[model samples]
Structure formats: C-alpha cells, structure tokens
Target: MSSPPNMSTTTTLQASPTGIRMITPKSTEEDTRLNQVIAQVVSFIQTNLCEVDKLTLNTGLDIEDSPRLIRVLDAYGVRYFYHGSILVIMGACPLNSVINTLVLNILDQRSTILPHELCPYFSSYRAGILCSGTIKGKGVRPQLRIKIPDDSITFHHPGKHTIYDTIMIEVAFSESRGDLHREMLQYFEHYRPAQLAILVKIEEDLSSRTPRTDPGFRDRAAQLLLRFGNDLGKEIHATYLENSAHDTSVRPEPFTDDEILEQIQVEDWIGTIAADVEVWDLMHSEPRLRGSRTRLFPTPDRNSVPYIYAGDMIPLALHDSFPNLNVSQRLAIDTDLLCMRMAALIPRFACWRAINFFSPEDEDEDMDYNADDDEGEE
Candidate 1:
C-alpha cells in the first residue's frame, strides 16, 4: 500500500452505502487516531466486533476499507486502489486459486520486457512492463491520484530513464466495475502516450460456513450438550443451513461494453471463455482483420506446446507494436502446468482437521474474502 509523503500507512475501508476504497492515515498521531476510531465504528457496523468474526488486517474482505478509517480529503473527490487481496476462488477450495500464484512465475519472466513480447511491434522503441504498477497523476486534490493497473507496459524515450505507458490491463470485480472505462480516461489524461487498455472481469463466490456473533455460544452450547445432549446444537446448526454446503463451480463474468469503452477505439477486443481464447475486432475496418485464438491457449489435454509461435503470426498480436527480442520464438507459456501448480495448495484447505471430515464449503458469505491477482491486468 504505497501512500503519500505524509501518511504512514493505508488500508481498505468498506461501508454499506459508500462501498469500499483505500484510505491513507492522517499525518498527525491524533488525526490518525481519529481515523482508527472511524474505522472501528464501520467495523462495528460490518462485524460488530464479534470475536469469531473479527477481520484481521492481513486477510479479511479483500479490497476492503472501513469507512471509519479514512481521511475524507474533500479536496480529492474519491479514488483509491488495491495492492493485494484475499482470493477470488476458482474451484471447490477458493484458497487454491490465488491472484499472485497465477501470475508471479510468469510475471517474473515477463516483467523486464513488454509482457508477452509485444515490443517488436514498436519498430525501434524500447518498452518495459510492470505487474500492478501504480500510475501517479494529479486528481482533484493535493495528493496524487494513484491508479494501480493490473498489468501495464511503458515505452522509454531514446537513451532516457523516463518512460510513458502504452498499454494497460485491469482485472475488475463486479462490485467496483462501474469505474472501469472512467479509469482508462484517467490513465489517458495523465499518461500522454497511453494507447490501449484491457479489462478482465471476475466475479466472487460465496462461502458456506456461518460465523457466530457470540463468542461464548460455543462454550454455552457445550454446557447445554452436557445436560441436554448434542440435539440442540444440531438443531441450531441445521436451522442456519450450516449442515448443508455444496461446492458449485462459478465462472468469471463476461465483459460488457460500455459507451466509454466502445468509443475508445478497441481496434480489437478478445475475451477468453472456458479455455478457448477468441479475439474480436470491434472497429469495422477495411480488409477485415480476423484472429486465430486456437494458437493462444493451445491445448488443455496436452501439457506441451509443439512449436514456437512467430510474433507476427500470433493472433491478438499488437499492430505496429514490435515483438520483444526475447520472444523471437520460444514463446511457450505452459498454461496447464501453471494451473496445476496454482491448485497445488487445494488439499491444505482442510486436508483433514478435527471435525473436518465434511468441511463442506470454504468461508461463509458473511466472511467472504477474495483477490484475483494478475500481473499485466487480470
């Protein structure tokens, strides 16, 4: 959570009416304390400080910010960003599919160059890529309006350190997705060379376990069971639907075109469904460009890619955009291998704990936490 010069730290603050947004600490100790108090109030509204339901600063509802904990700088209308989050859930155990796990290894290899070797399309320009890099620009206030893009590429000036953004990718959750295209406008407003932006939409899955507001309920139930037997506990559990929780796979939401996004000139827009990757040209043009997506995500059955793809031949290849020198060929990203590795942590979800035989679902809806991390845009 990078912040301005005066602030010490920042965290998400979520409220019912206001929604969620990151807020930075006030400079003075007293001012900071005031922020904490406000966060506590919002926390109380959201969780009532229940011992069992308390959210750890570390892993609570992702992209969360308690309304009580913000500096309310009227000067800066309203804008915030997220650095990290809990998990967006892939299969039965949401814990298995984390944002960082999906991209870190691939990101490590591509971070230094334009992600996916698109630099060659730029002719003589030297460009670089960053995962979740913060884009700083002035907004309505004194502090900088930081826009953290999921994945972004920047072009460097000839023999200079300063770089300007060219393309950006964003993984947007439905809750805050309304701001999607508007953010692209903000990026263009700040970065003069910004050309393209990709948007990825992923929805959230609900957990089934019910958290108790009363800390002493368990102990009280134990005493009651000693006298009245386990029937009471079983009855209460069944009443709350605690005994029935199933794992039904949920798919990511499809991207809906907005007036703003449509007007921005999508020379092309590609949306991957299931395992099939397809690209579409929203802009009607002469010659009619079509892309072969079969080549993007080769095979789910076979783990290996047979041949190296030439930069020019690949579908969705950036036009006029130079392919990175490193991606001349040898551009095989083992999607299957990465996926299996990403789900490697599934067993630990409840591999088996005391009374864990039927762990049923993951965390309940009331205690939902999610983050779909993607290096160069989700």
Candidate 2:
C-alpha cells in the first residue's frame, strides 16, 4: 500500500463486514485540507458523545483541544456512529498507525461498562418475575428486620436477669424480575449475614368455650407445631432458625428458665407467633399474594388464654406447641405448623418456599433514617 502523498499515512485496510470501503485521498493540496478537516470531525465526535463515553475516550485521546480535533475529522468527511462509547468511523482511513491508534482507542473505551452498573437494569426485569407470584402488581417491596432492645428486670430477691431480644421482618421487595432467591442473594451479598422473618396469618377459632381442652388439644397442637417447624426448616433451610447456636441472642442461655417464663409476656409471645403465622399465610395462600397486600394480626391488649373447643383445636395446637419452646425451637415449629395449615386450607400453598430476612439492626437504622428525615424537615 502506498502512503497518501504528503500525509505519511499508508496501509491496506479491510472493508467492514457491511463492505463499507474507506478511501484515502492522495493529493498534496487535498492532504493539507484533509488534515484540517480531520481535526474538525474529531472535535464533533467528542462533543456529541455521552458523558460516560466522553470520559472514557478523553483518557486516551490526550488531546488538549478535543473539540478542535473532532472538527478536523468532520471536515474531512469521516462519518461516525456512537453506540455507548463504541465509535464506528465511516468513510476513509489510510490504515496507518495513527488511524489504527484512533480506532483502538475508541474500542478501549467500551470496557467502562462495569457489571455492577448493569445490575440495576437487569434486576428491574428479574424483580417483575419474582413478584409476579405476589398479589401486588409488579412492584418490589422493602424487606426489614427488627431487633428489640435488651432490658434488665429488677427482682426484690437478689438476682438480676439479662435479656437479649431480636426480631426479623421482610418489609420490602427488591425491584426486579426473575428468580427472587438468586436476585436476593446477589443484592444482599455485599452486606453482613441477615435473615428475613415473614408473618403469615390464617383465620382460626379463638372463642373462649369448647370441648377439646385437655390432652387432645395439646396433642393436636404439638403435632401442628412440629409440622410448621419441620417444613419451614426444610424449605427455607435450618440456618435461618432464630434460636440456632449461631444466633447468640435467641439462645436460651441469656436467661434462666424461671426468668424466661416470667419475662416473656404472653402478649409478646402471641404477637410474635401471630406475626410469623400471618406472613406464612400470605406466602402460602392460593392464587398467590401481592407485595402491596398485607394481612394484619392484631394482638389483644389484655392477654387471656382462650378456652378450646373441637373447632379451635388447630389454633390451640399451634399456641400450646409454640409457647413451650425457646425462640429457635419456636421458629422451627412455626415453619412446619404454618406449612401444614396451608396444606389443609389451601392446597396450592404447598408449592411455595419461605424466604427469611430477619434483622434488628436494619430496622433500627431504618427508624433512625426516618427520624432524621422528620427532624431535618422541622
């Protein structure tokens, strides 16, 4: 290949896949004009490029006057198309090192599209799919975990009781489509280990008078509790058990058995159990539930153990089974009990898996953030 006259730029160039050929003009007069024109073209390309693309190209272009260079390229009649920093130059290239450098420099800029930058876009679609099984439209819900503060109780006797408390809840969903489990893992991978506690509610007989108040009630309740615990552990994994050895605060050692029985108010116990069951019901419901829809389990201000009839056998079974267990054991039991309850009332509920997201620190942070926002506006 002969060098273009007075340009000192020469080489053979392959046609693009689309067969667009670049023609290099060789006259001395034309060379001088082309150099001036090339400058203008380069200037235009730089100016019109997206901010992200421009930052990428600028690093290598190293030209103090990029706008001028682009204008020179424009004057020479080189057409360029931009696809996110990828510059497809049309027209003529003499195939010299200078031209090659320019092409390669533009290609190098393509590397700036990082994986994390693309995640949000990908998750938007994935979130839609994951939430499709939900009752709410395609919106993602926020997931939350709450930890109750630890407080000491005073006794007229000589002993002090140390208490540790925590709770987990899934308050929101991530905005994405596809498999929620995978997306959740990826989205939360950057944070410390956390568990999600979902509350599911089901209608149960709570009337104060009934027939099966003795061994039958306890037996059935224990079985129902065992069922929920087993299924939840199997479906969501045993690692999420609130009272697992790994979860120090939920362990039974923090307080003596007598203190545990005394400090764990009946209302607190029922409220926590009810919350878990409500979430289970939502997840296990037929036709599936939406993120926007919620089932509330209101705890009575005054606590009283309801009398058990044959109609109330199932709920009573759950209550008796749950109250006697420690936090971890209770979580395990609730998982199974809820699953069994769903099986009988709504057969379709058997197919879904429970995802846990229980964390107390996260809840506190959210509260603090909201408080700060309120204070700021004042």
Candidate 3:
C-alpha cells in the first residue's frame, strides 16, 4: 500500500465474510500520512458528508490545537479525553455502549435514581442522560487528564452548581484490554473522588450488535431481525423476560466475559469499600460471582445483574444526609422494574446502534469541507 504524494497515510480494503469490502484504517504512524487523514476525518465529522463510500478508520493524532479539536469532536459525539499533554480517545466503544443505552433508556421509560437535588434528573432537556455530563475532577495526573467515558452516571453537588460522575463506566474489547486495568487504577488512585470504576471487556465484535449472533440459531436470538416501525395500526405485543439467557440463539460467545468475570475478584479490587459487591453472570440460573469474600445480594433472583447498594454507591461525604436512600431496593440500577424495560428497549437500541455504527465512517468520496462553517457560533 502506497500513500498518495501529498498524503502519507495509506488505507486498505478490509473484505468481510459478508462480501462487504470497505476501507478501514491501516497503520498511520508516520506523521506525514497522519496529518492528511486527521484533516479528512475532522473534515468529514465537521461537515456531515452525505454521498460518500464507507470508510472505517482508526488512527492516532497529535493535538496541536486543543480548543479547535475539542469543538469538532464534541459536536460529532466522538469520545475523547486529555492525558497530560496527550489526547486519548477510546474509539469504537463496543460493550460500554450497551449499559450506557440500557440505563438511559431505563430512566426514560419509568422512574429515576438517586438524590432529588439533581433537578431534571435524567434529561437531555434537563441533564442530558440523568446526571448529564462527563467526569471532571481534581488530581487527574499530569493535572490535565480528562476521561470522557462511554457512558456515566452523574449527579449535581447537592447544593452546588457543579456535577460529578459517581459511576465511571468504561468497556474494552480483547484488543484494547491491556491498558484497561491501568487506566482504571489511575482513575481511582490519581483522580480523587472516583467512587466506582467499572471496566468491562467485550470479547465479541459489536460493530453490529443485531448481527453478532450465531447463524445456526439466530431465530432464538434476543433481538432478532424484525422491522420495528411505528404502529400504522398494528399491535406489537412486547414481552420482557420471554428472551431468556438460556436461549440457544444468544451465542454466549459474545459474552466471552467468563474469564474476565472470574478474574475481577471484587474483593481485591475494592474489598475494603466492599461492604457488599455482587457479581453474577446472566447466562446461568445461579451467580458464579462473589466479592473477594463477602455477602451476596439480599434476595437475588436470576434476572438481577450485579448490583450495589446506595450506601456503597453514594459518596461517603453525603451518606449521613440521605440515609433513607441507602437501601438496595431504592438505588439498584435494576430496582425499578428496570430489567423488563431494558429488554423492551433492545429494539429501539438496535436501530440506534446501526445508525451509530455507520455514521462514524469517513466518507471517501469527493466532498468539500467548510472551515468557516459554525466556527464562531456559541
């Protein structure tokens, strides 16, 4: 593969089993090639390139201009954060996306979580996604590291204008799992006030969640191929628990998290704070997860995902003020009929994932980028 004279970065055609040949990232290490690709990616993101061929790219960038770069990516919903002088982007947030969508949609359908102080709790119209915002705090090493998580649960400082993310969630796949532990530890140790850090490794490729299932038994898959259009006048009866984890079609391979589950001994991780830490795999009837050594869920059922009490989750600073909210029943993410509703939310999320998957691709065709466009607007 040779780079164009003016462009140092070269792209390769990734031919898929589906016979879909699309452009994906090739090593863009050489600075000359990177400058061009960065320009192109930024240009595409800044201007919604409509009629262009599909190009899935993953490349590194040198941040010479911080403000301008932040504006461009933030507008396009690209995940990025600062690490000292470095700008890190956890691109293609595969598994983290699942819970992000789950929690937000769960809040949307029914009920909310935590303190009532965070007015308009869970609102794009209010706080983008119930505790709307990214995690920002002090002592981020190098004093400039900013971690923009795949999704986060934030809350306002009871009586202050500031918002803080109590639950910092991030997901990584096998390829990117090496740095997962270190990054989280940094967040916990260096970044003060880091309450809970969830690092999940997504072993399966979630480029297309709906299509990631095994072909042999896809019929039994949780979110099968079904055109979910707004009702013209037809009834779409939806049942939550109908799609069991035991369904042969679910292709447990995707949840290749067994090894990860076993290794993340919650005790070693946060056992001291470990008044209680629940770990459970949904695939089986009983939970194989336990704290490094401690009590289990109060009265857990099969449907329960790993849950922690408000007592543990709430910052110790605010514990005494809101004693009533400390119980598990009130603050568990799945407490408010969250399980059934999360299942129903799968269809809507399928559409969202499909759109998000394709939208980030660079438009390889001829397109004009307007640098003057929206540069001065608030």
Candidate 4:
C-alpha cells in the first residue's frame, strides 16, 4: 500500500462484505424454449380434444396434498376428468393415458423431473373432479360405489362410531369356486339381525371348471370363516364373512339386496355411514337433549367391573333403568345417556366414512380449513 499497489493487485484484493458471488442466470433463449414447449402441449390437447376446456400447469404445486390441487382447480372451473395416482388434467379429457405419455416423454428427460412427486398430483386432481359429483352421463351414472355387505351387524354398526363402540377387528379370507360365496352365507345366516355384515369382494378368478385353480383356496376360505367368524361371535353377535375371487372376466353383477340375502342369508346395509354419523352427531348435542337430563346413578362402586357388550350395550344392574330414580324421572336419564352415546359416536364414524367416500364440497371445505391452520401456524 505504501508503494501504491498496481491496478491488477488492487482489483484482485477487493471483496464485498456481503459475500456475493457472480453467476449467470438462465438465458432468455432457454426460458423461451421451455415456455414454448409447455404452450405447444397444452394447446394441442385443448384444440383437438372435444371435452377438454383448459389445461392446468402444476408448476409449483405439491401433488401430495390433493385437497390443495382440487381447490385450485375449482377456482379455475375444472369440473370432471379421469384420474390415476398422479397428474390431473381439466375438462372431460378422454385421452388421459395418451396425455400422460406425452407429458412423460417431454419432462422425463429433465434431470429434476421427479415422477414420485408429480404422479400423485394428477391422481388427486382426478379424484377431486370425481368427488365433485360431476361424473354424470348415461348408463349407471359413471359414479364410484363400494359394495358393502347387507348383513345385520352393518345396519347396527353402519358407521365408525358404531364400529368402534369398543375395539374393532378385521379379518380377510380367500374364497373357492362354487363354494366361496355359499360357505360365508351358511356361517353368517343363523345370526340374522344379530350377525355381523359380510362384504365379499372378488380379488381373483375362481372359475368352476378352470385348469388354473387354487386347490388350497377353498379350504383356506372355509378355515378363516370358521376361525374368526365363528369364534369371535360365540356370544354377543354373529360372525361376519366376506370373500373376493381374482376372476373379473366371468364375475357376475353385484347381487341384488333380496338375492344377496337369499344367497348369503344376511341383511342389507347400504347408504353413506358418514352422512348418518354427521346427522346423528348434530342431534345428540342439541340444547333440548342436554338440558332435560338428570343423573340417576351419581356414583357406582369403582371396584365393580362393567360388562361391555358388542354394541356398547351395557346391562344396568338395576331393573328400573335408573336406580333410585322415579318412573317419571327415568325417561330423561335413559334418553340423555342414549343421546350422549350416539353423539359421541357420530364424529368418530364421520372420519372413517370420509375415508371411503369424499364429496367435492367436503374436500374443498377441508382444504380451506387446512389453509387457515397453516397460515395460523406460520
């Protein structure tokens, strides 16, 4: 410094306090190319397709949270479309597989293209549309439906609250050709109203006269029913039995209620359990029911073990329904307890019900709630 350092030396020694580094950003040319490619694909799909209205570019969206994607789509007016596990396109888009292939070809070559992260977005987008109840057309309504057993137990414990009245347990069994459906019917028929509902789904093909047959399948099916179904329901309720075969080619149409009962010898339990739970929960906590209640048994011996029944049907030791309470007063006590139990069960069942059947409105509302919670946390 005393000798007056050269210009080159002074420049080399100069450094900023902010630790800034000089680097070039992506070129305008490259940005133009990428945007052009995206536009081309979107335009091609929209112009040629009959049902497609607009294309959604999920550039920064996280595909894992389907509810978020659905909300975004709803804002943009995307009603219905088919969906897989990933990627969602708007409008009555018919060429879903073809569009997926095209998108993959273009994006797969990129080093940052993560299929795992991207696929679920599209899948959930499609699910959102379906849930919106927009998949209506001609035959069969093009709707998604789950076939539950029309057995007696399901009727009583149709939703989660009833199912979880105590601890819940589930068991699966493989069915045989001619006897898979019949065997389950025979085991559960005796219980009638008291028996658990059996929901049978065909997971594989079980042809009566097929060369490819599973010899152990029938025996295994019978054994499962006898063990779990018979053993568990020895006292409280009848056992539930359901089966599914792999063969879809020769699979018969879903059995009618009467036909299923006649063949399976059980009751029919249908309708949305989630809806029932929501309605029931609201009724239980009503001001009218809460205000008109009085405690008949204020205290019981802590040492006494309460006998828990299948339906949470605990038998009161006192014959008067409410011990030390008069006949006029007993009605209120019984009503209050029944209402409380039902109310408690509704929300529990609603959660379980939502898992199986999600309405579009429900999905949107949930997304809004999550957004609010996230904002609050931040």
Candidate 5:
C-alpha cells in the first residue's frame, strides 16, 4: 500500500552516522588557509626570534624593541608557545593577558614576573618536594657541580646526589601535576633511597592582600597550608616560624630577634585545626586598644590587661617563644593558621615579614637574642 518514495525524499535521507556529524571534513579552501597561516607563523618565529636557556628577560631584548615584535605577531594573530626553555609565540588567544604582560616585561628588561602568571609547563621545573643530603658520603667527590635541566645556573653541592636531588628541586616549581605521579614513581623505583624527606614551602604574595586584618584572605591561605601539607600524608612533621625586618617607609622599628627559640611555635594545635581562629593585630600601626588575650599571653583568671606601651609594642606573650601556660591544657592550633596570620599582617603593616620554618637548622648559632655582640678591641 506504500507508494514508492518520491525523488525529493530520497535526496533528504540522513547519511551514515559518521558522515552525518562529528567527522565533517574541512573544505578545501579552509584547509589551504590554515596551512598558509601555520607556514607564516613558523617562518616568523625562525627569522625574528633568538633561542635562550631560560625564561628570564636577560634575552638582549629591550622596551623599544618589544612593540615591533608584538606587531609582527599581531599581523598573524599569534599568542604563545613553549619550546625548550623559552616561551615562544605561535598564535593569539584573547584570554592571554598574563602571557602578554610577561612578554612585555621580558622586552622591557624587567627582573621578574607576577608569580600567579607564571606557567609551569613552559619552565622545566616539575611540581613536588625535593631533598638532598647536607653531608657528603665516603669515596664520593667532596664537591661537584649540580646542574638542573630546567635551570641554567650551576650549583656547587657538597655531595654527588645531584641526579636524584636535582629532580626533586625541578619538580617543585611545576604547577601542572598530571605527570607528577609517573615521575615520582620513576624516582622511587630507580634510586630506592631508604628515606625521602619531602620539603613543602608555602609562599604568599604579600604585596596583594592584607591577610592580618581581613579574615577571608587569611582563612583561604590557612586552608591552602592544610591542603598542601596536612592532606599529603600522616608521616609529615610541621613547624611554624617568623622572620621580621623593619620597613622604614611605614614602621621605624628595626628587625630584632626577640625569642630564645628560632622557630615560632603554634599557640593551640587542636583549636587551630578544628575551629576558625583569628590572630590579634599586634603589629597593625593603626592605634587601637590591645585585645584582652593574645596567642602568646592568655588572660589568667580574667586579669586586668596592662596599658598599651608607648613604643613599638613587642607583645612578648604573643610570640610562641614565650608560652606561659602548659600546651596540653590549651587548645591545638594548626601551624598553617599561624603562618596565614603572619603573612597577612606583612602587607597591612608594610613590613618585611617572612614566615619561614621549612629550611634545615644550622649547627652553630650565628646570633643570640639575649647576648650582646662583641665588638673587636680598638
């Protein structure tokens, strides 16, 4: 009863699934245009660029010369590419302002780029912790040159663990971590060292925010510290420390080592990890009545607080070095939370405040807080 299909219906029938969608071939004209663009970009990079060992701006290019380069790339709508150690230009993407700024800085002979803008893929550094022995082993050369594939600088180390140690340092700078698991596996399988100590460093860009006064930034940084170190494993050991230097621009106070202990200890370890905590703005220049209780000095049976000191008030009780009470009776505060508080205050106070506890301890004490330095006899 069905009539034969009309000629128009036959022409409208759907093609095979593969042919109907997803694999449509490019037109001959479109293919030709793309090939031409690729050829032009390759030629431009070859003729106009110089190959360098690293991504730094010491590439002999200057401010006057950068605009011309930008124009050349703009003509082809070029963005960026990574080849060897240098970031190369290939094509343009509208969302590449960060890369564009880096290129401008490189041309202008600037010393550094914004840390957030840096792409780990372009640099040879991979992301992870790296450790090397401090002492040299027997029969191994007492000194040897250490070279990193990603870095041009040649470091002189006391031991010959450069191959293994260098890998650790290289991976530390990397932001892309998809390939890290494979690289880590390779390292463990090859060297088979008895123990590996992972060094984790949390660096905050203090020029941007006030983590001390603002709770949001402080809380976020604290969270990152936990994610970076705490979530890594159970075998990890953590410590908190602070290094302060005077910013004559804001505070006239000179840097002083006010504590017997080098590293600043966290106030309450359990409380810091479990609940939200805020540090007193001890260093904030804006005058305000000191708080009732500080991390270093807790109120004892609700005692009356002393009047604010006239000069730069170094609240001795706030520093972890002076713990008047037993820690077991007090709450536990995470090291990361302490670090976050310290980092946030640096920018707000315009001081050279560094939260450093990751480095190895020196055997000899260079300076003592209580002892006065001895001047040479006249």
Candidate 6:
C-alpha cells in the first residue's frame, strides 16, 4: 500500500494531451485513493481560456474565469450561458462544474473522496404527451398529455429541471413568486423523486445576525416540498443559505503602518514626565501658545482634532521644570513627548487596516486610473 498524502505539498489537476486528466501531487502520493473524488472534481472544470499554471493557483476556480475548464465542459455535454463575467449552467446537474466546485470547497480536502456508488444524474424535463390549443389560424385543440420519466429518482420539473437519476433539484432564492410556488406543486405531484437536493441562495449577507420576519411564503413553499419528498420516501440534502462572495462595495482603504519604536519611545517619555508641567503652564510661558489650534497641532481639522504638543509647543514649560538640561537635551525631551501624543491618536484618526499617524485621505486615491481600462477588463 502507498503512504498517506503529504499535507505540506500542494495538489493540482493536470490534463494530458490526449484529454485524460490526472491529479499531480507534489509528492509521490497514489491517485487510486482519491480517484473517484478527483475524477468528480475534474469533470467540473468548465473553461479552456485559463492558463495551465492557473490549475495550481491558490485562488478559488470558478466557471467565469477558467477558460480551459470551459472548453473541457463543452465536450462533457455541459452548456453555458454568460451574463457579463458570470456563467450559468442549464441546471444543478451533479456532474456540472458549479456544483462540483461547491462540493469540493465545502470538503476542503485535496485527497477528498466522494461515494463511488453515488447515483447517476442528468438535467431534463418530463416529456411525453403534448396538449394543443387552437390559435387564430389553428383548427384543432387537443387536451395535453404529460409523460413522466420511468426513473425512480427524478427531479421535479416545471418545463425545465435538474434531474439526478429519479431525483430533481429544488432551489429557494431570496425573492418570492406565487406562480413559482404553484408550479412547484404541479411538478411535485407529477414526479415523486426518491431523493432530492435543495439549494438555497439568500441575497442578504449571512455574516449579520440581525433578525427580521421572513414572509411565510418561502417557508410555506419549503414545507410543502419537504412534505412531498417525505411522502415519496426520498432523502433531502439542504444546503446553507448562500450569499454572493464578490462584493466590491466592501472595500477597506489600506493605511500606512506607524513606526513601532517611535510610538513606544513617545509613550514611555510621556508616562515618565506627564505630571511635570500642565498645558496652562506652557501657554503662559510662550506667546505663540495663544495662537489658533490649527497651527498648534498642524493637521487638518477634518482628519484630526488639534491639541497643544508637549514636545514642540510646550518646550519652554519643560525647560522651567528641568533647569539643568541644555538646549539639545530639552529638544530631545520635547520630541519624545510629541511622539507619545501622536501615537495615542493613531487608532481614532487612521484607517482600520493601516496605522497611518497623520496622513491625508488624498494619499489613498489612484491618480492614473481610467474608466475604459475597467470596462475593457470586465
């Protein structure tokens, strides 16, 4: 028997020129152990436009960006529809690339294994009898005849459905429609699936725990479907309420890090001499202390509140207390005091990501950006 996979090494999918795909482990790990799961995963690669190296990249692979995987899926009987960068498959077919990506990400294991005996599946609607109605030019109107598939596990369909063996995939989205609920009933009555997979996608952010009343419609619809599944003696696998992972609006501005030594040196100096002199004492000793608050602190009023500094503005007051110190020694003491106060205000004035001491918002703006560049890339 071969040894267990080395977790430290990276794992990647490699496609042979002959179209056979294999998992290339960084070490000498065996493929037979994870063949079933790996094959299931390989089947999900959709786009052929991706670079060869991308198959090994750390980023999550999706149908929209992976071009080479796209071509591979086209050959595997999977079809795609694009809405901008986003790609949509016909349905949640088990072997489809999207579903495969979802399952693999959830498992989070490079050598993960899926059940070999998992049921075979497809995306199709129940087709058989056709009922016709007379239009203005048409002569005959006949009653409709619907033919349900003989498979034991089929997905419920309202014209189109994602089917696995005899089971149908049902999805619940954020918005509600009365017509969809009605159609769901009709589909459930016709195709009694032996098992089903219910996928729920909620547009709202799941990170928030704020409670709100859910309109009983979606819950009622789920209940009705679950009841139908139970009556049909089927197994139901329900997924978590999924939200969009790509949100450009959540951008956090990057800030600069403050020098750690400067901050610590300032803090220590202030702690050692905070009680030596007060602000009023410095203002009384120096004529410049009576000037505007803006000149005293130097930073803009919008970004930070101005305050008298012990290092520069209050040097005269420190000199009175430390009469033995020379000019250079007093200057050094003043600098340390200023550093401490500036470090204290860092958290309140700076961006959450960075530790900028007193930088302006304009420092974060990009100067050479173009609208056309963004449009062409999208």
Models 1 onward score TM values of 0.33, 0.14, 0.43, 0.16, 0.18, 0.17
lDDT (10s digit) by residue, model 6, range 1-378: 555655324445556576755443322232232233223334333212110111211113333433443443465453334333333333321111222222222223211221212212222343332212211221111111232221122322223443333322222222232222322333334333322221211121333321223333224223322322221111221211123132323323332234322222222111111111111112332212122222111121322222222222112323354333332221111323333443443332212111211121221141232222322121
Score each candidate by Cα lDDT: 0.33, 0.25, 0.38, 0.25, 0.25, 0.26
The lDDT, on a scale of 0 to 1, for candidate 4 is 0.25
**TM-score winner among the candidates?**
3
Please report how far candidate 2 places residue 248 from its true position, in Å.
62
Error of 2 at 59 (Å): 38
Name the lDDT value of residue 130 in candidate 4.
13
Which ranges of candidate 6 are over 4 A from the true structure? 1-164, 172-183, 192-197, 205-378
lDDT of 1 by residue, 248-335 (tens): 1232222222322332211111112122211112233211112332221223434333222232222233433443444344334445
Residue 132 displacement in candidate 6 (angstroms):
14
- Separate clash counts for every candidate: 26, 73, 4, 21, 19, 24
Q: Evaluate model 5: give its lDDT.
A: 0.25
Name the candidate, 1 or 3, with the larger TM-score value. 3
Task: Write candidate 5's Cα lDDT for 291-373 as tens digits.
Answer: 33222111112232222121111112222432332222211223343334433332322211111111212212311211112
Candidate 5 to truth, TM:
0.18
